[model samples]
Target: MTHDEIWRALDALAAENGLSASGLARKAGLDATAFNPSKRIGADGRARWPSTESLAKVLTATSTGMADFAALVTGMAAALPRGSRGPAARRIPLIGLAQAGGEGYFDDGGYPVGGSWDEISVPEVGDPNAYALEISGESMEPVFRDGDIVIVSPGAPIRRGDRVVVRTEKGEVMAKELKRQSARRIDLRSLNPAHPDYAFDLTEITWMHRIVWGSQ
Candidate 1:
């Protein structure tokens, strides 16, 4: 497709996901300011195309594919139309990889609060408390390697098979599968096949956030 067409599709895809251009970039783990409208034009006034990597990142972050993004670029109704710039889809707070494991980045309810965080944008998540995290460790290998970004929705229900981020009172926040939960403790299955299942006391857990999306 032509460069302008691809750019337009990116625009439509952002709208389809209820985010502004910059918001989408931030959610993709890129600089929150890189996709600003001002940068879309060269100093000489020529339209610029988004870099290949940037485009791939946004697509992955939004859980959208290139084919659909192409349809969006053409104004086709392949994807549902969302608010052009919904505030909820444009203001996702981002926690750094290192800081995400530290204290004060998450509230008692598993929502992000009270931390120095960067903001990003993505499609509507319905929860005002939704946030993003950048993966920086090899612990969650295969499923999520370093540099991947995952979106967490605290308000979303935690089902049996859903992937989640759980924080313990001992200051450990980890991503795992919710195998089961009892009043006393919770059972977790690791994404890494070689890792064994874990059980943690419910009281030892502080909060948990269900992962809604990821860019890996």
Candidate 2:
């Protein structure tokens, strides 16, 4: 399997079990930091993969079959049994990226609130608090163009290299790739190289949500 797909499958497994990556590692009798984003890369900047033994332990701990795990890796876990069809589409809140920076769109915990939001039908996401944001500028172009709709999941685990939407306490919102996150700071990489990368203190961020899907 591809490196990204394997890691994503592991994350999906953890989420499906109502556990964080560290929690899944702990449940499998591995070190609590084994699945942390920091552990996914090495000191020399190379990818670090989870050992087969660790994967086996996780499967045993969760009682998940290899076939099911493979499905997750292939992003077909949402399909019906016997490969019939995917989950039905459902309505979720939709808002512009610019408007998301304004008040009345979200609760303190970052969940979409208020009743004035427009709605769009998308394939079902596990997170009930998921919502969509329509892109507006060229700052994130080449990857996310203007008018692109991205699905954001507040409940999803954030990992290194994942694209995310971040909102600052001062009411600024932007989408970038998560380079790294430490206790005190977060590093972000812009999708468009012309745009400057960003680094912010953890305190400056009001919320950061993973972008689970995007309409290119």
- Compare the candidates by lDDT and give the number of the best one: 2
Which 10-residue window of candidate 1 scores lowest in summed lDDT?
Answer: 76-85
The best candidate in terms of TM-score: 2
Writing each residue's lDDT as its tens digit, candidate 1 over 1-216 gives 455556656766677678887788888989987677777888999877788898888878998866566545533322123323333446688976667778777766777777488887676556677788888777778988898988887776565666789888888878898999887989999988877778998888888777766786
Give the lDDT of residue 118 in candidate 2.
99
Query: Compared with the true structure, what per-residue lDDT tens digits does model 2 show for residues 60-154?
Result: 99998887788677544532132323555678999999899888999999999998799998765667888999999898989999999988888
Q: What is the C-alpha lDDT of each candidate?
A: 0.74, 0.86
For model 2 the local lDDT of residue 166 reads 96
